[model samples]
Target: MATMPSIRRASSRTTRGSAVALALTATALSVTVFLGGRTRGPAVSLSIKSPATSTISNGARCQSRGFRARAPGVSVNLWSGFGPSLGRRGLSMTVAPKAQVVELVSRVVPAVVPEDDVAIKAFSSTPSEWKGDMIIIPVYATPKPEGAEEGPNAELTGPAKELDGVLGGIISEMIGDASFKGSKGEKVSTFVPGGSAKRVALVGAGEKDKENSDTVEALGASIAGVALDAKVASVLVVSTGSQPDSQALSSGVLGKLYADDRFRTGDNVSKPVKLKSMEIEGATSDALDAAVKHARGVTSGVRLAKDLVGAPPNYLTPSSMAGVAEKISKDLGLSLTILEQEECEKLGMGSYLGVAQGAIEPPKFIHLTYKPKGEVKSKIALIGKGLTFDSGGYNLKAGAGSMIELMKFDMGGSAAVLGAAQAIGKLKPDNVQVDFIVAACENMLSDRAMRPGDILTASNGKTIEVLNTDAEGRLTLADALIYAEKLNPDKIVDLATLTGACIISLGNEYAGMWSDNDDLAAELLESSKDGGEKLWRMPLVESYKEELKSKIADLKNVGGRAGGSITAALFLKEFVTKTPWAHIDMAGPVWDAKAGGSTGYGVRTLVEFVAKQQ
Candidate 1:
């Protein structure tokens, strides 16, 4: 929970028809009446007798006036005011119990803390100008030789040189002793005895030649990990070597500061130490401004994705998920269209409905659009698989294959696209129009659940044979991909946690990419690289389509055990024929086994790719 600034309370009770005169200021606005004339301890009535038509924007004065009322049972509504329509509105209200008034006001102000309360700032100032609880300096894994001079080593070239001089060569001595080689994920900390800063932390950046946005972001997150429970009010990150990508570095810090402690209970519960501010040093004024804009969009998308994926299945059902989408559209001013299950059936989404039939929850097909102010430069469609929970249907995941408890995360792709929509909607590019699509549903075990050997047709008239019910993600995506193609966008990209075979091929650190067009594949690769995401291009393998061919239907949902990921991609390719399309299989990197929580993969990639369309 975030600590609220001091609030001023004004209280007073007046008998019915008896008026109390009060002076109103800029911070405190007029009052609104609730449950009018309801009586309890003291029947306090309020009327706006003053002609204070001017509105106040300051929050402090509002708190001050809230507590200054004379009536004991009177309560001031913090977020109330009068406007032109109801001109000459005043602050006169009646209340019930005296004790209930104060308690209600207290509860209303700081009840639920939204996830984006923390602020991240990037500054053009030097290390010496930053004073905080802790300052982090990133150093290369290799250090200068014992007898090496100052100009020869790149690590000592920038603000780091001045920092070392201030600390009496402590950084150099620590690196010289071979104790802190600055290897990735390595850290060392010490107290700054003379400076304004209380502590200084050194983080590893690996080899200089191999440095990229990923390495820089990893180093930033590593620093945040140490500061998590240190009760540090503010953090400062200083660049020692070549300046890393400012946006990636700052985003990593912001993503870590976000905590999902909403449901935590018990006396020993750990509360995240709220950070007052985060500052990164050593950038020009213009550069700092650009970095701040990009980081704001990317971090917001990442946090939203993490929040959705972290939600339990029961709490985030298909209906509730549509509710969230509706709220986002309302808040961000995006055009939203939600199709009910009956409407989807009209479009002949047999493949999608087949997987959804087992669950009691109704399916929702979500379509959200973002348009620029000027003439559009390009059109792009982003589709995400929205299986809120996957029980492997009738195949029934058992033993080692069953990770049913963690099935809530199967909607990672949906979270990413929605997160990107939340970002692009706010960061509105001037040239591109984007459509975000998701077919949200669940695959649960029941009498109506989809079974093996089921034949289903997609919206595009292509049939799929469901050989293995566990391969249901692709079934849901088939109709979504077909729907996206009908929009006739220049390019389409779909993200999904489709197959474990990709994890086997590329480990948990990388996502597999399959594309039919070379240019589209290369562009997405470069965008992911700049966004600090790892995407490895895999072959479309023309021959792999042979494995998906079925005896009766157009294709099979699963292609045996060999090259399973490629075959799944091939199945989706059947639906998208014209528009250049790329498929991202992110089964592995979406969730991390590390102690704290999810890594929030693919959000940055989607945001970056869409932003570039500008």
Candidate 2:
């Protein structure tokens, strides 16, 4: 484990307003005073009132207005001037105030600070300071060039140091660290004392920079993570500028926050945390409200997925997975059907049943449908390989392969599909119907367990040669994909932790994607980028199909070592006739030994894609 640097506490002060203002001008200043459990100090209130212009002047009096501070000598200063179209710019006293915070902060701090320093600062801040908080940030924005609003690269800068410090502190605390490791140009947190706020966050906005929506989203997420955990009911984001739209900033931040790790579980086993409201300062009230709503919805979807993925295998087994769908249908007014082992047998799912035969628990084939509230325009089907566990079957794994103990994540595909359904159910888009199909079972070892070289028939009556029992994910998906095609879907997307070859091909950073349709691939790629899930498309070579051809069986369960991932996808492609389809191999992302936990990878990307299509 890495040790984070401690947040150095500055000394306390009770100077008249003027002395505190003068103190702020100095390079290193600290003001620490214990206010009545609720009230912050007078000088600190003045500083936050109008951080840009309100110099820490002498004898500043603190007056309270609902949790906000008002005082003499407090005035607002616009940095570069406000505008709708300012390109990227760094934060400097000389630059226009319109710059984005990310650019400005990036220039001042080392490149590494975005991830490391932010994490450190966030973790170092005390949780008490973060409790029930509202941190205000003042920023400047620049005007855009005439008639160039739609031109490429019209993005702007964000808030300044005050904002970064607050965000960093919140993030560090959430991840149980004082510092953060994040993407580039992101500001970390800094500390401020004395205000109604338990903690005041100050972020810097670079001069003359345009805004990047993604950066704002990240900001919102960081804030929410801290606020919710701190048991804070609300957060007030104060922006300084005539044209500063609080709604836009809030929307961006909240949206991103809601999306990231929305589908996660805390080890503490505590009750769920909820955020009540977010108030925006210095920006339009409409934008603030819109931001709040968007954040709520996005986070709601993410949390649903996280809850499903985080559940242990015992609680989320095949029958339990079916039960989950049944409950969702009853609660959300959706349609659901659960097929038992007898039904699957009637459908001739021999290849799928072969894997289930090993386990004492019966397998379940779940079909969950979401009907449109209005006219249906597009119908899509999602198939997930719900292998509860993989024990390597007859060709039992040994030594390093024994690490397959975490194979419970083999059902990660099912988690993603179920998670997507939950999100769509809440959003309730019109004219788009979606069906979720999961072939849920366990691949265990027993007297009746499947053996290598065994031949099994699929639901489509196609015989499969099971050369390796370890390759059971594809076997289950084969029947599920065929079942999805029966619905005549406009598009079919299947997710599975099917192959280790995928881990080798794309590493842990990216999921391996195989698709025959270019349009589907493009749409999925765009969704992945928006959702912050990395995916790399791999070719489905025509030659790879040869590896699955068997002398007796219609296809072989395991392909050759070379292009093993691609061949596995090729095997699945044979099940779908004309429906545009894509396969996501999530072997690398399902579980993380290095991180000592599960990643919950495909849920976000799948949900985003489905929501966008609707």
Candidate 3:
């Protein structure tokens, strides 16, 4: 089994922070960069093949190329394509009748990491030391005098110029010929002859002033995408910017490459996740290891959440949700307590149980806790609305714009919370105690399902009139909020795919945040911004609570259509008497149809919120 590289982190991060970012000062000294045209070969496709008698230094038989198909139980990993040359077009692979070829491939590829686990050491590594497949250099476009060519001429940075000279000016020539604009997410690749690396790619990046943690992370994701296109196993990222950038780039890279192909078969399988390792050039050692560790934690957490949210409702019931939580707690060494339906009834959790009445799947009230070893500086609670499925009960969701077909993601909030739990568990950040709770269940339509106008009592002893059975998320959260408050944590935050009104208000890019506490709201905002998750604070209007006023009950589950998101927040506010609380209605961003996947949106923002706590 492969073990993590020994961390040679510098004494204190404060010392490395002064090194001024992972700035690609390529030559160790600052110099001007240029793309002046000179004689050099263009990026081209190549094919490389080896003799059958050839054997790798590790005594494993391998090839320069591989087939898309693998024998049952066969795997192709990091050492997949370390042959003499980069193969393309002509050298296609076919499935072997026997397991000999695959077995040989597996021999070269060490099973150090279980396929799902992950980083780029966000530190300096000279090109001479790397015998990797590709090197991606991110260049930003700077304004300059208009020239007689494609888009305005790019003003190369110091690192770009140094590498251009080292690579024999092929990068500059490729940029000019390809009209490479250093805009975000843009990429152009080229081949190198007698260069520092085998193949090279110059990707577009945002300007110096526009660079931040989020943008840097986006840039990293772009670099990973380009590398995947190149189909290379290892890469060296020539990082940009002049700030302390660690976790952002690594998370963005691995997160972008994340896939849930568990059920895929034959050609339906996603990419092999072939890109194994990445190294950051010219970075501080401490920052690099720190970045790798945090990025793996957060992104893996995100992948876990994505897998859950992407799963079909039937495959991820309340029982299975609790099962998954159990596995996470056991694996991460966190304390766990699962309350069954009967147990919940004894505690008066009528509001939460009401939604589960119609489903064959029993309700699971899950609590996973992470306690610091010594002094606990603070405590916080994270709750996810774990509605495995929502059929809208008597208020069957049906209309011109019904999302009932995609209701599986109604539990995105729960996915986010648990995802953050996995990350926090792995990181084990000191001095903060975190409680993760999920009231897992399904809201289905049946004779036993709660009907509209039925009154349900929450754990807090407050009555709620279920005027719209579709507003079931708030009902589940009402009980959770009350349950979270009982713990007496420093604060509480709950996420739910609770309202369509939020999607209409904020679109799919941002989560609607509602909190009465100014400090809590601001703190969360900063975290989201840093993590590259969009969040907008909606007013917790006191007057909107009138819309939820019920004649027969203390409150109605929903309010009038106008400012519906605001009223949803107000409805949840009733459960909390003290302990700063915030509600995130992440409806639109939960499931991204365009990307054809779940966003796993709240993990980073939530992790930042907890980790930043003193």
- Candidate 2 deviant stretches above 4 angstroms: 1-132, 136-198, 203-214, 225-233, 240-276, 282-298, 592-596
> Which residue pairs come into collision in candidate 3?
2-112, 43-191, 124-282, 124-283
Compared with the true structure, the alpha-carbon lDDT of candidate 3 equals 0.74
**Candidate 2 residue-pair clash tally:** 82
TM-score of 3: 0.79
Provide the lowest-lDDT 10-residue window in model 2. Answer: 113-122
Global lDDT of each model? Answer: 0.73, 0.61, 0.74
lDDT of 2 by residue, 1-614 (tens): 43322213232323223222222332212122112111222333324312345444332333321112223322221112112232321111111111222222222211221111111011123323434465534333234347864222212123323344544544234222422222223233434455446655433333325444454554555555555555555566544333333333443444433222322468643344445555554444455455444434444444444444555555555655666676668768889887766578678888888898776556879999989878888898988889877778887766785656677778888878886777677667777899999998988876557788889899888999899998899899999999999998899999998888899888877888999999999989988876667888999999878888999888888779999999999999989899999999988777655644555577667766876776
Off by over 4 Å in 3: 1-119, 122-125, 144-151, 239-244
Model 1 residue 524 lDDT score: 91
**What are the TM-scores, per candidate, against the unseen true structure?**
0.75, 0.65, 0.79
Q: Which tens-of-lDDT digit does each residue in 1-614 have in candidate 3?
A: 42322212121121111211111111111111111111121222212112322221111222321111111222211112212232311111111111222222222222233224334665354555567789888888664436735447455556556667776778789888977778787788877777657898888776666778878788878988888888888888764344336677777787778656655788997767778778777777786788778888898788778888888775676766776787788789999998876578779999998898666455889999999888999999999999988888888988878888898999999999999999999999999999999999999885447888899999978999999998999999988998999999999999999888988989989899999899999999999987778999999989888999999999999899899999999999999998899999999889888887788889999999998895
Flag the better candidate by TM-score, 1 or 2. 1
TM-score between candidate 2 and the true structure: 0.65
RMSD of 2: 28.6
333-397: candidate 1 lDDT, tens digit per residue: 98999887657878999999889877656688999988888999899999988998988888877
